[model samples]
Target chain A: MMNTKSLYQEVILDHNRKPRNYGVLDHPSHHAVGHNPLCGDRLDIALNLENGQINNIAFQGESCAICKASASMMTAAVKGKTRSDAETLIQEFREMAMGERDLNHPHHLGHLTVFSGIRDLPTRVKCAILPWHTLHAALNALSSVSTEADNDPVQNAASHPEALNRQANS
Target chain B: MVSANATLAKVTPRINTILDTDKIRADFPILDIKVGNKPLVYLDNAASSQMPQQVIDRLVRYQTAQHANINRAVHYLSEVATLEYEHARRRVQQFVNAQEDREIIFTSGTTDSINLVMHGYGRKFIEAGDEIILTTLEHHSNIVPWQMLAKEKGAVIRVVPINDAGELDIDAYEKLFNERTKFVSLIHVSNALGTINPVKQMIAYAHQQNVPVLIDGAQATPHMTVDVQDLDCDFYVFSAHKLCGPTGIGMLYGKAALLEAMQPYKGGGDMIASVTFEETTYADIPHKFEAGTPPIAAAIGFGAAIDYLCSVGMDQIAAYELDLLNYATEQINEIKGASIIGTAAHKTAVISFTLDGIHPHDIGTLLNEDGVAIRTGHHCAQPVMQRFNVPATSRASFAFYNNKTEVDALITGIRMVQKVFL
Candidate 1:
């Protein structure tokens, strides 16, 4: 059993109510769509990178609170960081969400560490990481021939049995 | 005074037709388990029903005592297993009131059954310029296969629209039929919305044009009485897992003539008559569709589930479930910022709703904390969700085992979710 209070922390509820960077970005350098077919959580993430650093980032679409807040905090965390630093932070966040890294010592995640509660609720791990996944796809679009945001990589992860069963049970 | 007694006589049977839900709950062991220190209030019956001890016992009995492949051997276990397997087929045949045992084709589940028909019938007869009519309430299982067939055969797909209350627009359905309309496939009940389509009338309408129809009864069988013969549908499909039986097993009931006319969906050991180097022949009706070694234990468990349902009586189960639905709907209606979707006049015990400010996934998660299990998603009926203009909805589907107390818990859970969001 997990503590519901920990899972739906006050920070999460506040961010969910008034999510930051919750709109589309115009003339974006990269964009990608993340979808959780199980719950129909769809988010379109757009990023503006200037000189190897994230100049601006925004997201749009409907999703659960965990997803929206993660997107909100992720935008605030990676706003001025280099693309490589942003990738490292996302990897760290993913590891924390999946219970792979020590959540008690989320040294560099800053406020993103609030999502560490996802380690206790396995079903929500995908929700917490969905924005990061879309961000990863957006970043990868920088080097790819096609700039169209393709989130098939994230869709495959969401459709995995472990994530699907968790969504089904919830 | 005499009139009052007559009214009492008329209503006494219904009032007295109480389901011993506590006893029924006892038969299902999972209901006893707690979720997060709270008693489990399972309301997701439309997704998959929990198995009863009788069905579990049947599976165990099959595995321990009658374990053998059917129709292949002459030994004692083989003979017993074959008889039991065939006996389960008959049980399903009788449960759906099919005309003959041969009309029942066992498949993996409802999806497999629909895919079988699409491959067997649609691929065989449906050609260019043909139109297949479907309703907006169909689950993806009923929709995607037809879409594939239409795309493959150059056939046109016509849709029947629905009203705001989630009732099928019968006028539009009747208007869609023409000389080009070759077939109709409609859901007997909307799994997401609980709208029970007028399938009998719809089938009759299709038959008037000499077009055949298939009925998706996945959500109907658990909550209502289904007479496939009475409905006169060309094909009917349902899953056992939705009726308190095991998964990986379901039945497809088609008219004998249609089944005989159609091609077999798969080719393998059991479905063949004689295999040669150059040519291979097919077996008879039910065996022709069943390609390989089927889920023997699950099939026997499905028979036990049917027996248990019969003992409870479908009418009594329907009545008790209606009571639960009504109570839950009324309680849910009282919640502020909560609106129920799909309010069809004719429906089963399903309520799909959305909170004003809360996403359905959040509602589902919060409800889980309170041990009230419900389904929240597009429910594999994205068209229906699109029609309702919601990405997803939280659905609380009732079964005969549920009581008013559980409905109250659901209402309380919804309020708690609202509190958290607000």
Candidate 2:
């Protein structure tokens, strides 16, 4: 198990205490609410996309320190990046949280690697990943996302929109 | 820090000596194991308790000496297994003080027991326009089954609201009952808040209206003595795992008349007298409900768990746990930013609290670092969470085996959680 000390380091604590970009965007082009039903953590991600580049992003919700810190760091990491670059960061963060990618290997996680300790706690992985998942949903124009494995229609629709479309048509 | 230590030292000596808690702790082998470098302070008894060696030995004895499918053949092992299983039923009957052994039906767990009643009695009796009265304090197991029944039968479900103190609103509960009220199911104790509800009075009121009531005793049975006859409840359900027994086995104590009147929940071997192509005859009462080969070993372990609890004496257990609760509550109340959600006048050894500016999940993860295990979530009682207006609360539920020191560890752990966040 990763040291709990390392897991709740000063950087993560600072982000949780005073999360940056923490508010609703004014008439955002994209918005989604992320829900972790297992722990009752909810995150609202709203961002404005201008000319295929992320302009302004803000998050506000009731979540644990890990999730709040993740959201805070996530908003900072992808503020000025293009949509594709933001998606790549989301993918990398997911991999890092799930222990799919080794930190020793070259990656673009940057200072967000502070959350690398989350992989040791299976229950808290969703806490660290919910923000990224909501960001994914917001970018795709999905209104909501849930971490619940069984009833996550948002995940299915996002992963296979054509399949969902076919079903809806049928 | 010195004053805190001094206060703890003063309280430690005052801990109720009713149950030799140290001796009781020795029975549960898991209590000795270390979590990381620290000793495990397990305060999550409301979720599931650790089993004692006595119950473990009983399971081993049954599997090694008397392992066979019950009621199948005239073989020697079958008779022994069948006898032991029935003996376990008698133990359960005595445990809940049910009138007869036939009143106790072995179920998979408390959820299965509730679902069985919903299927057997609910599907058969409840009709459209009828109402089933439930409480906001109910676990999902007690609520969802009735919901499914209500949806299928076009029946309505009326919920009893709780006060801010987490106690059931008795006047509101009494008012919810009317001519349309058909059934009532409520929790004996709030698992999320540890409020010991006034169920006996509610049951009496339900009886006056001729509406049967089912008490979800999953949280109560582990703490106090529950006499179904004394309470006059129509049905009482609880899980063995909560009482330091094996999982996958629980008891549903229904009044014999109700059990006999209800349709069979499941149909298979052992629950039938005879089967034919055209007609099938079902067995009587308890056998009628216990369809397939039951969890023989788990049931036996459950009986052993009952035996162990009885030896410890439920009254003594209750007294000792109350002392622990008092100490823990006193300590937690002293914390600056922590606020307890459920402050009911009557409660078991459960404290659900939230630290200011820190979520319960964060509190739980940090506490685990100091080897303190607590439940941090909705606790399968979302209605209670919604009523309290919190996403979730960190809960520390105490069992008889837990001592004042464990409670102190939990308090220290909470302080550490605050420090980490700070």
Compared with the true structure, the alpha-carbon lDDT of candidate 2 equals 0.89
Using Cα atoms, each model's DockQ against the true complex is 0.51, 0.59
| Candidate 1 RMSD to the real structure | 6.4
TM-score of each: 0.93, 0.92
Q: What is the lDDT, from 0 to 100, of the residue B260 in candidate 1? A: 99
- DockQ for model 2? 0.59
Best prediction by DockQ: 2
Off by over 4 Å in 1: A104-106, A143-170, B1-17
The models' CA-based lDDT, in order, is: 0.87, 0.89
Error of 1 at A137 (Å): 2.1
Model 1 over residues A48-166: C-alpha lDDT tens digits? 78899988777766888888888888888888899999999989999988989986664689777777767877777898899999899889885422234354323433455443232
What are the C-alpha RMSDs, in order, of all predicted structures? 6.4, 7.0
User: What tens-digit string does per-residue lDDT give for candidate 2 at B200-284?
Assistant: 9999999999999999999999999999999999999999999999999999999999999999999998899999999999999
Candidate fnat values, all: 0.66, 0.79
